[model samples]
Target: MAYTLGIDIGTYETKGVLVDTAGTVHAQASRGHQMLVPQPGWAEHRPEEDWWGDFVFVCRALLQDSGVDPAEIKAVACSAIGPCMLPVNASGAPLMNGVLYGVDGRAEAEVQELTNRIGEDTIISRCGNALTSQSVGPKILWLKRNCPELYAETSHILTSTSFLVQRLTGEVVIDHYTAANFSPLYDVKTQSWVDDLADDILPLDKLPRLLWSDEIAGHVTPTAAKAAGLAPGTPVTAGTIDAAAEALSVGVDQPGDMMMMYGSTIFIILRAQSQVSDPRIWYAPWLFEGEHASMAGLATSGTLTHWFRDHIARDLDPAQAFPTLANEAAASPPGANGLLMLPYFSGERTPIHDIHAKGMLFGLNLTHTRGDMYRALIEGIAHGTRHVTDTFAELGQSPKRLLAVGGGTKNALWLQATSDITGIDQIVCEKTVGASYGDAFLAALAIGAVRRQDISMWNPTDRTITANPTADYDTAHALFLRLYEQTKDIARDIG
Candidate 1:
C-alpha cells in the first residue's frame, strides 16, 4: 500500500506525519523551535537554521518512528506559516533572516510610503487589497529601502512554504493562495505576477513561478531524498499557506463553508463561487481552480492566551494549566462582567488594518479575579472573530456553519464563546489535524486517490457544544464596539 508524508513548519514548531490513502495517520513527530525577537515588534526566523534544518529532522524522525520504507511513500507535501518575506541569494542561501508576516512591524514606514504612492482606491481595484501590513508588497519595498545590500543580493524572494519546496524539489514555485498575499506584486485579475508593478518595485524574474496548490511541481532530488529518508523522484506537489491547508483539513470546500483556524493567529476563510474585490478583507484563490476565498485574520489570538499564561499563570504547566484557566473562565458569566479586551498584542489585521494598534483591556475592575481576566481574554478573541464574520456577511459570502480547527479547538470555553459572540453554530472535528495533515491530503489529491469534494468523508465531527448569546451579552457586545472606537486613537498613540 502507498503512503504520503506531510510536513508543516509553524512559528513555534515543526511537525510531520505519515498517512496512507485512507486518511489514517501512521506516525507523527514534532520538534520545537525558537522565534527570533531581536527587538520589539520584530519577528524573524533563519531559513537555514529553523526552516530547512527542522524540515529535515522531522521527516527523518517520522520515517524512523513509523518503520515505513521510503520507497512506499508516493509523494511529500509541506505547509508553512506564510506570506513571509525571505530574501535568497543566487545559490538559494538565505541573504538574511526572514521577516515574518503582519505581526512584524519592521516595515511600518514602507507601508505608509506604499499607501501614499498608490492611492488606496487604486490598490484595492487592481490588487484586490490595500496597503496593509498583512500584504507582502510593502514588506518587499521595505527590504529594498532598508536593507539595500541584502536586497541587491536577493536572486529570489520566497514565502516559507515556497522556500521549503524549492529545497526539496529544486523547483521554485508558490501557489495562488500564498501569492495573493503579495498583492500589488501579483496581478489577481490575470492570476500572474504583475509585470508592470514588479518593474516599479520588485524584480519580476525573482518571483517564484505560480502554480495551483495540488499540481505536481517536481520530484524530490537525490540530495533531498537522502536527507529526508524519501526515495528520489517522489512526486512533490505545490502546497499552500498553512491556513489554507488547515481549511482543507477540516473540509472547507464550497461556498457558504467557512474555516476558523485557531493557531498563533485566528484565520477566517470564507469561500465564494467567484472573485471578491473587497478592500476590507483579503482576496485569494481557493485551493482549487474556479473558486475564491474572502479571508480575514487577527494578528493575535492564541498569542493572547500565551501572554496570559506567561504573565498570569506562570506557576502552572501550560498543557494542564490552560485547561484549569478555561475552567475558571467558564465559572464567570458571559461578557466577563462588562470587561472587554482588544486582542492586538502584536497588531491588528483585517477590518481595521491598523499596524499600530495596541492591546487593551477595558472595563477591568478592582473587584475582578484572575478568572475574570481569563474570561475577558477568550471573549476578546471571540469578538475579533465576530468582527471578521461581520465582514464576511457584508461581502455576501457568509458561512452557514463555522468549522473550528487547530490547537485552540481543544478549548471548550474559547469555542463556545466564539459561537455565542458570533451567534453562529461551530462544528468541531473529531480528529483535528493541523496543516501538515492537510498537506498529506493534498498529496493524496495530487495522486488521484481522492477528489476535493470528498474531503467531508475524511473529516467527521459531531456538534460538541452550541452557545447562544444572551440579551445581556448582546448589550455588552454593543458596548465592546464603542469601547474600541473610543480607544482607537489612544492605542495607536501608545504604539
Candidate 2:
C-alpha cells in the first residue's frame, strides 16, 4: 500500500505520522525540545538540534516502528512553528538559532521603527498585515541592526518550514501562506516578495522562492535521504506554518471555518472569502491560489497552564498534575472564584500587540486555592479568545464553525470555559493528531492521491462543545479588559 510521511516541529514537542492512502495510521512517533530564552523578550530554537535533529529522529522512529519501506512512502510534507526568523549561510547551515514567533518580543523596536518609517496605513494596504512581533520583516531588521556580524555572514533567510524543506529537497522555498507574515517584505496584492517598502531589510535574492503550499518544491537528495531515513528522489511539498496544517487537519476548509489551536499558544485561523485589511488581526493568502485567511493569536495559553502546574501545583506528581489541577478547577465555581488573570507571561499578541504587557493575578486573597488560580488562568485565556472572536464579528467575519484542536482540548474545563465565554460552539474532531496528520493529508494531496474534500472521511466530527453563556462571565470579561488597560503602564514601568 502506498503511504505518506508527515512531521511537525512544535514549541515543546515534535510529532510524526505514517499513514496509508486510506488515512489509516501505520505508525507515529514524537520527540521533545526546548524553546530557549537566552534573555527577556527573546525566544530561540537551535535549528540544527530542535528542528532538523527532531525531524531525523522522528522519521527513523516512524520507519522502524511501522516497518514501512522508504520507497513506499509517496510524498513527504512538514509543518513547523513559524514565521520564525533564521539566517543561514552559503551551504544552508544555520548561522544562528531560529528566532521564535510572536512570543519573542525582541524586535519590538524594529516593528515600531518600520511602522513609523513606512507608515501603518501603507503597510496594511500593501501587505494586509501590521508590523508586529509575528512579522518576519521587523525580525530581519532586528538581526541586521543588533547582530551586524552574523547579519554580514547571512546568505539566505528562512522560516522554520522553509529551513526544513530545504534540508530535505535542497531547494529554498516558502509557501505563500507563511510568506505573507513577512510584512513590508511580502506584497499581498501581488502575492510576491517586494523590497519597495523596506529595501534595507535584505536583498530579495536572500529570500526563498515562493510556491503554493501543495506545490512540489524539490526531490529529496541522497544525503538528506540517508539522514532522514527516506528514499532519495522522494517528492517534498512546499510546507506551511503549523497552525495552517492544524486547520486543514480538522476540516477548516470553507470561508467561514476557523480553527482554534490550543497549543503552546492560542492561535486562531479563519478562512476568509476576501482579504481582511485590519491591523488588529492578520491576513494571508490561503494555501491555494485566490483564497484568503485571517489570523489572531495569544502569546500564552497552554504555556500558562504549564507555568501554573510547575510553580503553583508542584506538590502534585508531575504526571498527575494537569489532571489533578483540572479536577480542582472544576470544583471551583465559574468566574474562578472572583479571581482574574492576565495571560501575558511572554507578552500579548493580536488586537493589543503589547509586548511589554505583564501577567497579573488579581482578586487574590488568603481564601483562594490552587484550583481557583488555575481556573482563573484558564478563564483568562478564554477571555483572550473572546476578544479575538469579537474582533472578527466586528469585521463581519465571525466564524460560522469553530473547530477546536490540540492537547488542551482534553481539558474539559478549559474547553467548556472557552465556549461559555466566547458564546460560540466548538467542534472537536476524532483524530486530534494536529499538524502532523494534516501534513500527511497535504502530502497525499500534493501527489494527487487524495482530494481536499476527503478530509472529512479521514477525520470526522466527534462532538461539539455547545455555548452556554452567562452574565457572570460577561462581567468578568469586562473586568479582564479593564484590568489590562489600568495596569499596562505599570507593566511597562516595571520592565
Candidate 3:
C-alpha cells in the first residue's frame, strides 16, 4: 500500500503523521522544543536543532511505530510556523536563529521606517497589505542594520518551511502562500517577487523559486534520505506554512470557508473569492495560483493561559494543571465576574497592528479569584477574534462556515467562550490532527493518489458550537473595545 508522510514544526512541538490513501493514520509522533527569548520583544529558534532535529526524530519514530516499510511511503510534505526570516550562508547553513512570526516585535522600528519611506497607502496599493509585524521585508532590514557582519555573510534568506524543504530536497523553493507574506517584496497582482521593492531591502536572486503548495518541489536527496530515514527518491511537495495546511486539512475549500486556529496564537484564515485589499488584515495569494487568502492573528492566546498556569497555578500538578485551571475557569461566571483582560502579552496584530501594545487587566478587584482571571484571559482572546471577524464582514466577506482546530479546541470552556463572544457557530472536525495531517493529504494530491475534495471525506465534521450570546459577555465585549482605545498610549508607555 502506498503511504504519505507529513510533518509540521510548530511553536512548542513538532508533530508527524503517516497515512495511506484511504485516510487511515498509521502512526503519529511528536517532540517538544523551546522558543528562545534572548531579549525583550524577540523570539527565535535554533533551526538545525529544533526544526531538522525534530523532523529526523519524528520520522524515525513514526516508521518504527507503524512498522511500515520506507519504500511504501510514496510522497512527503512539511509545514512550520512561518513566514519567518532566517539568513543562511552559502551552503544553506543558518547564519542566525530563525526569527519567529508576528510574535517577535524586534522589527517594530523597521516597520515604521519602511512605512514612512514608502507611504502606507502605496504599500497597500502595491502589496495588498499594510506594513506590520507580520511582514518579512522589515525584518530583513532589521537584520541588515542590527547585525551587519552576519547579514553581509548571508547568501540567502528563508522561511521555516522553505528551510525544511531545502534541507530535504536540495531545492530552494517557497510556496506562493508563504512567499506572499514577504510584503513590500512580493507582488500580489503579479504573483511573483517584486525586484523593485526587494532590491531596496536585499538581494533579489537570494529569494527561492515559487510553487503551489501541492506542486512537487523535488525528490529527496540521497544524503537527506539517509538522515530522515526515507527512501532515496521519494517525491516531496512544496509545503506551505503550518496554518494554511491546517485550514486545508479541515476542508476549507470554498471562498466562504474559514479556519480558527487556537494554538499559542489565535490565527484566522478565510478563503477569498478574489484578491482583497485591506489595511486592517493581511492578504496573500493562496496556496494555489489565482486563489486568494485573507489572514488575521492575535499575538497571544493559549500563550497567555500558559503563563497563568506556570506563574499563578503553581500549586497544581504539572500534568493536570491545564485541566484543573480549565475547571476553575469554568466555575467562574461569564464576563469573568467583572474582570476584563487584553490578550496583548506579545502585542496586538490584525485590526490593531500595535507592536508596543501591552496586556491590560481591567477592573480587577480584591474579591476576584484565579478562576476569574483565567476566564477573563480566554474571553479577551475571543474578543480579539471577534474584531477580526467583524473586519471581514464589514468588507462584505464574512466566512459562511467556520472550522475550529488546534490544541485549544480541546478546551470546552475556551471554545464555548469564543462562540459566545463572536456569535458565529464553529464546526469541529472528526480528525483535527492539524497541519501534519494536512501535509499528508497534500502529499497524496501531489502523487495523484487523491483529489482536492477528498479531504472532506478524510476528516468529517464532528459537531458545531452554536452561538449562545449572553448579556454579560455583550457588556464585556463593548468594554473590551473601549478599553483598548482608552489605554492605547498607556500600554505603549508600559511596553
The pairs that clash in candidate 1 are none
lDDT of 2: 0.95
Please list the residue runs of candidate 1 whose C-alpha ends up more than 4 Å from where it truly belongs after superposition.
469-472
Write down the RMSD of all candidates, one decimal each: 1.4, 0.8, 1.1
Model 3, stretches more than 4 Å misplaced? 469-472
The pairs that clash in candidate 3 are: none
- Give the C-alpha miss distance for residue 251 in model 1, angstroms: 0.6
User: lDDT by residue for model 1 over 112-209, one digit each (tens)?
Assistant: 77778777777777777777777788788888888899999999999999999999999999999999889678877788888565356697889999
lDDT (C-alpha, whole model) for all candidates: 0.85, 0.95, 0.91
Could you give candidate 2's per-residue lDDT for residues 114-173 as a string of tens digits?
999999999999999989999999999999998999999999999999999999999999
Model 3 worst lDDT run, 10 consecutive residues: 469-478
Error at 194, model 3, angstroms: 1.1
**If ranked by lDDT, best first, what sequence of candidates would result?**
2, 3, 1
Q: Is candidate 2 or candidate 3 better by TM-score?
A: 2
Candidate 1 TM-score versus the reference: 0.97
